[model samples]
Target: MSAYSASPSTPRTTSRTPTPPRTTVVNVEEFEMDGRSIETKSADHVPIVFKANPFKHTYPILRHTCFGVQGKQTCEVRDTTTNPMFRDMEEDDPQIQYVAKPFRSKSVQKPYRLRCGVMNYAWGKQSTDSAVAQWMQEGDPTYQVEQRPYAELWVGTHTNAPSYMQESTGSSSNLVSENSSFANQSLHEFLQRNPATLGDAHTEQFGTDLPYLLKILSVATALSIQAHPEKSHAERLHASDPDHYPDPNHKPEAVVALSNYKAMCSFRPLPEIAHHLQTIDELRALVHEDMVERFVTVVGSDGSSVEAKKEALKSIYMELLLCDSARVQQSIDAMTARLRNSTDLSWVESTFLDLTVQYPGDGGCFQVFFLNLIELKPGEGLFLAANEPHAYIHGDAVEIMARSDNVVRAGLTPKFKDHKVMGEMLSYDTQPLHIFRPNNEGPLTSYCPPPEYPDFKLLRVSLTEEWPGVSYELGKSSGCLLVTQGSATLLYCGKDCTIPTARLEVSVGSAYFLPSRLSVYFSRMTDFVAFIGECQIRAG
Candidate 1:
């Protein structure tokens, strides 16, 4: 049993290379099909072959079923071609005898190479400055870094920007295309045909596709201040206006910083907001005097329930969001002008001025005072639940979310704004954003979310010279892996008590689609760091 196995109860071994299966020998004569005669010295080496039908290219010419004979210690091979698509197939056929052995199914799941899509949004970091671009370039030699900004690298089966699986052929791998029988296929299409890859629990809950979308973001400027709708609200929005809503799925996302990162997330704590409201005269000027006084009074009251505080916060936020654009702009101009010459300024005040310069007169500038201004060092993370407003300010990060693109933007973007929806959809929870720290378990650092969010969880693998290897049990969920640094060799062992069936060299920016119910071993050649996004399987 390997020490890195997921559990002691499930003992498994690992090897640098695969062990060949034992074989039995039997004698057989040469067989001919479509004028092609294949000879074997003994039946032990005769291979089962399928030839493509010329007329019906989609269907194969022959199908064989082999069963072991008890007394003879050999196998009887029979043709079971019953498809109506095959023309002139004979029912009476001679059975060929051969040595029986364990047969592997063609439908068995294996790791697949992926070609992810890149988004070049204006807020993205430019070319080589962008981690998204650098990773994409490393994974794909064909990708060229242009002068344009590269914002995100999306890895999922979303129809908006689906990832394509590359088919390995001999020494080269090619992107699966429509013309090939099954070589080039979108991740969504492939999952439709092989739902088992998603695991039974995930497939039962989320259907054929992945419930989560993984992304690598490179932020040079601020993203739009936005909130995602809840499931029911998303369905309604998609039904009424799909042009903006796109998909009928809610997005609850989390981001793990890869560099020094900054963002505005959720609502500030009641006391914090109360303090800001009391001190920032310019922010207080945007909302009505009555609303501001009511918010401060409610927050300061010890008898107030959490629900009461939430209502108070919501009222204040809605007042600010619904304020006239001219009035909001006037307040922002006053605040920025006053803070410009101040020698001492709080982080929040500095962020407000920066946003003002980027998006002058935008209402999101005022939002800084209302939301928690969070700064995350590398590996630190925060979850933004559905209906919670957030906007990435700067830096690089890897993010995972419930598969959705439904964003209701209010400000700081040239994109369409839905101030009414944004105001109504916000949860207005005033708890300070909780920073997630990965729980270290050997070489694996797990960032598992609370049980309420069962869509996805992230695992970070760090391999150093001191601890050069690790094994991960895929259990009952499919996962996507992105190698962000250094190099390693992967040994893929599917199911339990099985030797590795495949071995591949992986390096920085290499990405793979790992199938469900497999154990994968990684041996580091150099320091390695990779992130795996898998469906969260709750334990009973």
Candidate 2:
């Protein structure tokens, strides 16, 4: 017997008899169908028939009636029904009352494929050597790689370069066929129309715009030594010089190594920097003698507070940046000549030579001694706050940051350098580099940022052959997922269906925009790895 089966009922009479209407409350999910609100009342049966439409293929709308008896509510189809739209339904079900209305489809509220944008910077790797180029080729078969370098693959709704919708997935054949205009729409435009995808709490907190931008970077050479301004300073810079400072937003970034990666992070420990300044004659020549003496004295004194040490470091750094250009070049030349003649050189000396070769006579070359030079293995990560000076030296990595592009360059580039602003804005607190280690749980590893930076988090899913399938519940926040390795079959089963209503076959480099509160299952053919970038807003 069926679970919905009930005892036999008497037949209806032709003679009409009026009865007083009474209110009764029953528990059941409510939704609109054919422009009518479905509600339960004090009645034995209220038949319903879902109109056939494009969404019928995507959403599972059942044909049933509510039975309210003795304060109890149950749903069942008590008789057979015949309709051209529902010929596949069971013949024994009760007849349903059909309401005629024009068919209308709801806004998109599910995962869809995305086509991200790519940037070609000079520091990027050339041709297929770059992971960004390779991923671009994999995602778009029509894309052709040229001789120029490919640097970053941007996956967000930043105004400079926004991602577009490639395709939408579901069982809705009419939606896919008739509503083809949804494809190729910018993600920013889509979010404007459908704010629910970002969740109510997120939209309220972050204002409908995506809070973070995800990027895949392939570095072949050293990038410019730069720092991003804080929120207040960014606004001031943008208002004063809009060309150089493109946006009025701070950019706090975190990077996870996809391969062996080398980068210059925050300033080194006070003792280490003081030692280098005292020993390295070439480095000490650029800064003023008085400023260097004060910095060394402050750093060496045990009684000096952290704030005093930071002020002293800032004084020396500013002197170095504001020094005469000819003296900076002469210092670079002296360092190069000495390093070439010396047989034994430390990594710091070797890196200094490399920077001088890449960017000759640029004062940024001396930053190697002042900053912490760190190398990260695969899976290792680092977080850089706003106003902290850093540069990516080489290798591939996944970088996520606030949606902004306001960089104050110090050197190593032909672009406009804001040396004065860069010097004043830097947070010259010399501390050891703290590497972020992900919290691992089975096949999933979460790279959560510090509590102060609650804008975004990264989740990495690694599926091995032994554990080939996993279910991911997105809870109540939207996110973008990119497949970095292998391939998998994704299944999305709606709330009312026992089987999947949408199935997508994804391969390496594929990216999808996942809606809020959606659960998806993945079945892999082989070892697979994917990263999901999501906002950290709390659900309301």
Candidate 3:
């Protein structure tokens, strides 16, 4: 039987008619980059349906290139002209890396989105009030840019910049930051005064230290093996090299697998790495005998020379990172050929080959075999703590971490490659492979797990049949809930609100903050994943 029944008879004793389901109404205000309020009249300049996803096969067709095609206009050019903000964006801009899509690989098994921050660029380009009119009514009337994107896809939120909407897009809520200070008022305005659950409150509380972080990852290739710095290393580096390093904040993160996830975790035992490093027949000829001997000496039988081995590896990494790409590729190719033929190749050897193919010239390709290989089934996850090193291989995962955007790159990237700095800042201490797991310790234990970073916690909420009817409470922590699968209704304010699974319906991008006092219920087709995290503020 349905949960809410129809009442044929009127409300007799109370003399009050049952309240009909109320329509969801979101109030989005306009603002400039400098944080000034603008009138809704300016919305014509920045139409709600500003731009759609640039990918071709995806719904709400995306514009990839800088040029506008026959029917579709290129968002790059449109963004440049319409929202002149891109000119100010530099590589060092906190928002750039803050919202960067770090997934890049050649063996991606499924479709993934890229450049979630691109939406922010769209928003920065023009106020919705001004751009909307130009894209829509200025054209052939009906042929305006009015199609909304999917909520699952990247749009706008505090984590990342909101993509300007050309049309009414997602099945979920639309996210917009009216003023610079993202507060409960904005949450109230976005969700239309609905009371949030405790989980919602927890996710909504991302404070001022680090306000937002979001990404839409597509794994076209397998990623290299790597991990991020803990708060200590990050702080030290930030203090040491203020110009080049990351902000000194904890980086505890969560990844919601958008597709099948494949990655490499920490290094295998020293014996394992040494054993594999020795068995390579072809590699023996490619590398110098002296270098090979050094590796053997460092990897003794007892594994007693741990510090020596680490130092040797540090030296080798420096040499390789400093060496020309051609030289490195030659060694990689030789190893690949040898591993391809040998059945006895060690796990590390095989991993090297896999990453080499995924990232041809990346130095990270060489480091793959030293780490643990983790293959995440759809909806499965692997978390990493501070100092725990890990690199994403292939597939799109919704990543939620602390507000700080400090990343010291080691390898497997075209953007930034700083081995010296990374080496100094990285935690070489060995640890277990399973970083993300259920917290057996805590007061608010409801499948919501706190990340390695004390500042943040990530909860993976998938509505299963077991949760046929689950009511998620909003804890004291403000939080954001990003739906990754299926459609569901959020029961709030004494009524049920339907949240569609379609991308266009959930255009609010990666964040949906719920306050502490409110609670919400979910009822939908099973198998929906949400990346819930604490927001930066608290409502007194």
List TM-score per model, in order: 0.78, 0.77, 0.56
* Predicted candidate 3 versus true structure: per-residue lDDT over 1-540, tens digit per residue: 011211112222111111122211123233111111111111112111122223222111111121111111112111222334334333453322111111122321110111123332211112223222222232224543333321223322343344221222222343221222323233323333332323343345532222335444445445434455666777877898767555776666656565666777666666666665676553444356677678777767466466777776656545545666777777777767767898886655666776776577666776665566777765555656665557776555666655555666677766566676656544544555554443222111122234324454455555544343333444454455555555554443211211111111221123344434333445444444455554433344
Runs of candidate 2 exceeding 4 Å displacement:
1-109, 168-179, 438-441, 493-500
Q: lDDT of model 1 at residue 160?
A: 72
Candidate 2, 399-508: lDDT as tens digits: 88888999999977778888899999998866656577643435566777776776788877766654455556665568898888888766553322322345567677
Best by lDDT: 1
- Model 1, runs deviating above 4 Å: 1-108, 169-181, 538-540
Point out the worst 10-residue segment of candidate 3 by lDDT: 32-41
TM-score-based ranking, best first? 1, 2, 3
Candidate 3 TM-score to native: 0.56
In Å, residue 339's CA in model 1 sits off its true spot by: 1.3
Native-to-model Cα distance after best TM-score fit, residue 394 in candidate 2, in Å? 0.3
User: lDDT by residue for model 1 over 19-133, one digit each (tens)?
Assistant: 1122122333223334222212113321222222232222122223222210111121222243332243333533221212223445445678777888999999999999998
Q: Which predicted model would earn the best TM-score?
A: 1
- CA lDDT, candidate 3, residue 462: 52
- Comparing 1 with 3 on TM-score, the higher-scoring candidate is 1
Q: Evaluate model 2: give its lDDT.
A: 0.72
